[model samples]
Target: MRILVTGASGWIGSASVTELIAAGHQVVGLVRSDAGAAKVAALGAEFLHGSLEDLPALHAAAREVDGVVHLGYVHDFSRMDDAARIDRAAIETFGDALAGRGGPLLIASGTLGLARGRVGSELDQPDPAVHPRVANAAHALALAQRGVRSIVVRFAPTVHGAGGDHGFVAMLAHIARQRGVSGYLGDGANRWPAVHRLDCAALVRLAIERAAPGAVLHAVAEEGVATRDIAHAIGDALGLQTVAVAPEHAAEHFGWLAAFYGADAPASSAVTRESLGWTPRQPTLLADIAAGHYPGD
Candidate 1:
């Protein structure tokens, strides 16, 4: 299959490109900058120069590929509404190109807030009213009805690995270093799901190859790791104390990351494993953190 991967220079996208190429598929990576193109080329993928805002470029790339792994998202949390708008437009553009084509379109989404106070599963439907990105996931799933094999792969909040992981876990580590103490929110009982980056990349490859239309898959390896435990791990690594911040002060302490650190969005990948014959054979979250890979040695 010839796959077009948007955000191909990104953490997960780059990994996915490597996985696909190793599986004997041709990959065209969508990149926005010269450095991004060089990164994609270094990964042995043909580079398609464009950003998510370029609808014509996106449509052209979508139309030219056998499948698309849409992983591009504007990560500016300060302007989430604008980011969501761009995501919606990009997905819609791809959907229009792939509509009635029976081509697979695997989109990256999140499992956060899919279930409240319980382990989320593939069966949970994303509430469109909650987050605009969740709504975008719903819209992508609807494309399946129009003959597009659209699958939404909801990633765990923390996708950690050895190299270049700037996700939530890295943020926590950075914050800990800055504050001199590793902190968690409100007794630190909230749970966060996580996966290794390579494991996540393998799952994306599987979804592109075998996932059914409209399928929602979880790329979680560890269902939930407690916030306190995560804080402790960071503290241990940095030789600092682990402490808990009151819920009221969570936002003030953690800033934009407070909501994520305080969330209890545990998720399971049992169905994803069984359905796609996929298994995550990587170090667990705590193990990865303790392995000294996160703090950059």
Candidate 2:
């Protein structure tokens, strides 16, 4: 199958391209920069220059592919509504183009905010009121009714690996180095699910290939890693002390990333594993940290 991938230049998206190509599928990666284009090209994928907000580009690209794996997202927390509007438009464009077609449309969603104090699963639903962009997943799933095989893959907040990782774990290392200590909020009891990027890419390939219509898959490997444990890992890596930041002082300590670090979004991938036969082979998040993957500066 020939696949069209948005955000093909991104971390997981790039890994997905490699995975799909290795699986004997032709990939057309949608990218916005020469660097992105080169990354996809190096993976032997054809490149189309466009951004997610470009509806016409999305329509044209979707019309030519057997499936789509949408990984592009504008993660501007301050201007979330604007970012959501762009994502909604892009999903709608694909939905329109793929309507009446039986091809798969796999989209990336998050396990964050889906649940608190407990583990989130594929069975849980995200409220659109909390984050407008989350509605894009629902919209994509609805496309299944129009003869499109739409699958939503809700990923853990921390998708960790070595080298080019810029996700939460990397940021925590940077914060630890900058602040001279690794801090966790309120005894650091909260938890966050995590997966290695390669494992996540494999899941993407399986999801686009065999997922049922309107299926919601969890791309998690470790169900939960306590914030305190993560803090200690970072401390060990940077040779810094691990400290517990009081809830009231979390904002000051973590800056804008405080809320995310404090969130308890543990998630399970049992359904995904059983449904797709995806067993993660990559190293765990803490192991990656120990390997000195996320170096501050």
Candidate 3:
């Protein structure tokens, strides 16, 4: 299969391209810059110079590929409307190109707020009100009815790894270092699920290879690692004390990350594992933090 992966220079996209090429598929990564092109080329994939907003380029690339793994998104919380609009346009463009074709269209989503205060599963429908991008996944899923094999891979909030992770976990560490204390919300009981980037990439490869149309999958490894535990791990790594931030001060302390850090979104991949025979062999979140994968190492 010839796969076109958007955001192919990203943390997960780079890994997914490597996984796909290793499995004997040709990969063309949609990149917006020469640096991104070089990065994808270094991973043994061809590059298509484009961004998610470039529908003509995306449609052209989509029309030529056997499948698409849509991972590109403008992740600006301040400009969520713009981000969602761009993502929705890309999904629609891909859907238009692949309608009646039955080729896989895997779009990334998140496990957060899919189920509040409990463990979320593959069957839980995303609430667009909770996050702007959820609506885009819903749109992609509707493409399945038009003969597109649209699969939504809801990634855990924390996709942690060594050296290059700039996601939530890394931001937490940076905040902790700046504050001199690792902090959690309220009583620090909120939980967050996580997965390693490589494990997530492997799952993407498997989904593109074998997952059914309209399938909703969880790219989560640990079901939930409590926020307090996570803070303790960060504190251990950074040699700081773990503290609980009150609701009134959360914004002041964590800035735009407060809402995300305070979510209790645990998710299970049992159905995904049973359906695809996919198992995550990555280190646990706490273990990664203990190993100094989060900075201050």
Candidate 4:
């Protein structure tokens, strides 16, 4: 099968390209820049030079491929609505093109802000009308109605690995470096879900191949890694103390990341594993930290 992958140069998307290629699938990776195109080509994928705004190009790309794995987003937190708008438009453009085709359309969603103080699961429905991102996922899932086999793969907050990660784990390390201490909210009892990046990529591949239309998949390796333990790991890496800070001061100390790191989004991937026979074989957060990935410069 030939797959058209958006954000093909991104962290998860690039990994997915490698996975798909190894599985003997041809990939046409959407790249907005020459460097991105070169990177995708280096991964043995054909490059489609276009951005999300180029609906006609996106449509053409989708029309030519057997499936799509959309992993791109603007990612500017301050302008979240802008990112949401772009996602919605891209989904609409691609889904419209793939309508009545019965091809797979795998999209990236997340477990954050779904619910608080509870473990989010594949059985749990994100309020389709609630968050803008949630609404976008709902829209993509609805494509199944039009004969497009759309699926949403909700990833955990922390998708960690050795390098090139700008996600939660990297943010925590950067915050610890700036603040001189590794801190968590209150007693740091809240939990955050995690997965290894390669494990996540494998799940995306599995979903593309086997997930039923409109399936909502969770890519959570360990259900929940305690925030306090994460703080300790960061502290151990930076040779600093792990301390508990008041929730109110989390913003001041941890900056923008404090808002997310302070959240308790313990997500479960039981359904995903049981349904797909997927198992993650990567080091856990604590073990990865202990492996010296966060050593000082």
TM-score, prediction 3:
0.96
In the range 27-96, model 1's lDDT, one tens digit per residue, is 9999989999999999999998888999998998889989899998899978999999999999999999
Candidate 4 structure, TM-score to reference: 0.97
lDDT of 1: 0.92
lDDT of each: 0.92, 0.91, 0.91, 0.88
Candidate 3: C-alpha lDDT: 0.91
List per-candidate RMSD values in Å: 1.3, 1.0, 1.4, 1.3
Tens digit of per-residue lDDT, candidate 4, span 102-153? 9999999999877766888898887877789999999999999999999999
* Candidate 2 residue lDDT tens string, 1-297: 999999899999999999999999999999999999999999999999988888987999999989899999997878988988898888888888888989999989989888767778888887867777688888889999999999999989999998899988888889999999988999788899999999999999999889999999998999999999999999998899999999899888888898788888889998999999999999999999889997876
lDDT accuracy of residue 276 in candidate 3: 98
The order by descending lDDT is 1, 3, 2, 4
Q: What lDDT would candidate 4 get against the real structure?
A: 0.88
- Give the better candidate number (2 or 4) by TM-score: 2
In candidate 3, stretches whose alpha carbon ends up further than 4 angstroms from where it belongs are none
Instruction: Please list the residue runs of candidate 2 whose C-alpha ends up more than 4 Å from where it truly belongs after superposition.
Output: none
Q: Candidate 4 regions off by >4 Å?
A: 295-297
Query: Model 3 over residues 1-297: C-alpha lDDT tens digits?
Result: 999999899999999999999999999999999999999999999998987888898999999999899998887878889999899999999999999999999999988888866789998886767666888888899899999999999999999887788899899999999999999999888888899998999999999999999999999999999999999999998899999899999999999899788888889999999999999998999999999989842
